[model samples]
Target: MSDKPKIKVLVVDDEQDIVDLLKYNLEKEGYEVATANDGIKAVKVAAKFIPDVILLDIMMPHQDGVETCRQIREIPETKKAFVIFLTARSEEYSEVAAFDVGADDYITKPIKPRALMSRISALFRRESKKEQENVQVRIKDLIIDKTSYTIDKNGKILTLPKKEFELLYFLAKNPNMVFSRDELLQNIWGADVFVLARTVDVHIRKVREKIGEDYITTVKGVGYKFD
Candidate 1:
């Protein structure tokens, strides 16, 4: 925490081009980057490098992003790694799966370098801010520890990422306080941020999945809350 330490990044994908392009661009931005070609090796590299963040691709030869994320979650060393899913899947169901597996963010393929840089910058900014942030919140049965960045439901630890954890924290902090998507976007994602409402739904759905279905009540015409 003394200075901006080397930002180690591990990118996993089957496509050599994506890995090369990301490494080139991320290195251009001065981040220390590493690459892995599949889900299995991704775990190994992640343990070795303990990367500051991970850019994970969903489809690969042996294992896919979902299974890889599951494996990564199992390893305590990579448990807190900030992961972003880089893939070509744009379906709502696919996005929901990505969130369920602890993706900090989802960026589709055919990436624009400028927009990629912008989004990466946002993540870096958020990471910098999180350096001083505490990660603890207690709900009825859902307990969140921001310091360790772990969530516990009924005393069981639930894996979550920066954004999803923050979203849950915001909702838990104000239990029973209904928040519209606009309000949530402002409160959780910043007031000026722009993301599809489906993003919020995906996150909420994931939270519900981690804890239990029906743990979060949907407000039909409004937003969400912890039930």
Candidate 2:
């Protein structure tokens, strides 16, 4: 067996069969898997499991996935975990809410195990490639560190959700080069993941909210750039 650690995945759904199915398939692929049948239990499991990825369902008893995700993101241990929403809701608002709560990917369910696996693998592959190219971008008093996934502005350190951080870091690195919404979506979310163009705008807005508006500039009718 390879000495590299097995990737830990937390599968959270109200359906037992779906959880079991995912757990079985994930284990077959040599991943360490954990399961929770409700959002309440999911948060408890995630706190201790600290899985690298969390597969969540939008609607659940006690707490919904969006609120659970928001709570999960607040937890220091699970903050960096990739949260993928696997739900039956495909409405645009549902998708937008998922992304707003820091979801990395959204898939409407009837779960195809193979396709889900491919998306999961793609997430890891993209992350692996990113780890190899990690660098810190310092712009004035603001410091964007890809290594720790944190930013420092005027001596105060703040943490952004994974996508927001990556968006900011990407723009800071390129400095002054305009990238359209489609381009940002392709580069940040990757071509393998199907993310809406509005996702980019949402992320940019969130990033700006955290880091302030001085760093990223929106070019009218064009796109966004780090100035």
Candidate 3:
């Protein structure tokens, strides 16, 4: 028997066979798994289960993965769960869109069960490590708390996605130090993340929009630094 506690996972896909297969394999790995047949159902299930990870299918009836993920982020109960998108569309645009809407990871469909399991395991491990670091930074009226995985601006709590929060926290922690896009990717997402430099821009845009534009200064042709 494994000593680690069971991590809850929610599988959201319209295809019944895929959901069953995922649930079976995840259960065998000693994870607590739940299923939802559509995006609508996924929201309700996620609200109740509050899973540690969510395997969300992109194309689905009623809500679609992007919208569903956004809704999940809005919900305080499930907003913190790590979301991984599962889709047959391997286009870069789709992957970018997934990240734009708060997906922690994106995987093309027809993924091997073992590979999926590995990704999930890695995500959990990263989250665990993050929890161990209780660093907090305060810049002006903004407060970035790594321990709570939250940011507060002028006493207003900002509901930022995971990547956006991490990006902001990283830049803010170092104060005026400028970091290139490649450096941000390597430090934040690690080597295994298959995302382009443009993805960093997308996350930066989101962070700026939420926390105000002056928080991040773009150093044309160089990179970005926290103002």
- Model 1 lDDT per residue over 40-148, tens place: 9998888888887888999899989988887786677777777778889877776667756666677888877678767767766766775676557776877788777
Segments of candidate 2 deviating more than 4 angstroms: none
lDDT accuracy of residue 12 in candidate 2: 94
- Give every collision pair in model 1: 135-145, 135-146, 136-146
Best by TM-score: 2
In candidate 1 the C-alpha lDDT for residue 28 amounts to 90
Report the Cα lDDT for residue 185, model 2: 84
The 10-residue segment with the lowest total lDDT in model 2: 131-140
**Top lDDT model:** 2
Name the candidate, 2 or 3, with the larger TM-score value: 2
Using TM-score, rank the candidates from best to worst.
2, 3, 1
* CA error at residue 47 for candidate 1, angstroms: 1.5
- The TM-scores, one per candidate, come to 0.78, 0.96, 0.92
How are the candidates ranked when ordered by lDDT, highest leading?
2, 3, 1
Task: Name the regions of candidate 3 deviating beyond 4 angstroms.
Answer: 1-4
Candidate 1: where are CA atoms >4 Å away? 1-3, 130-135, 138-143, 151-164, 185-217
Model 1 residue-pair collision total: 3
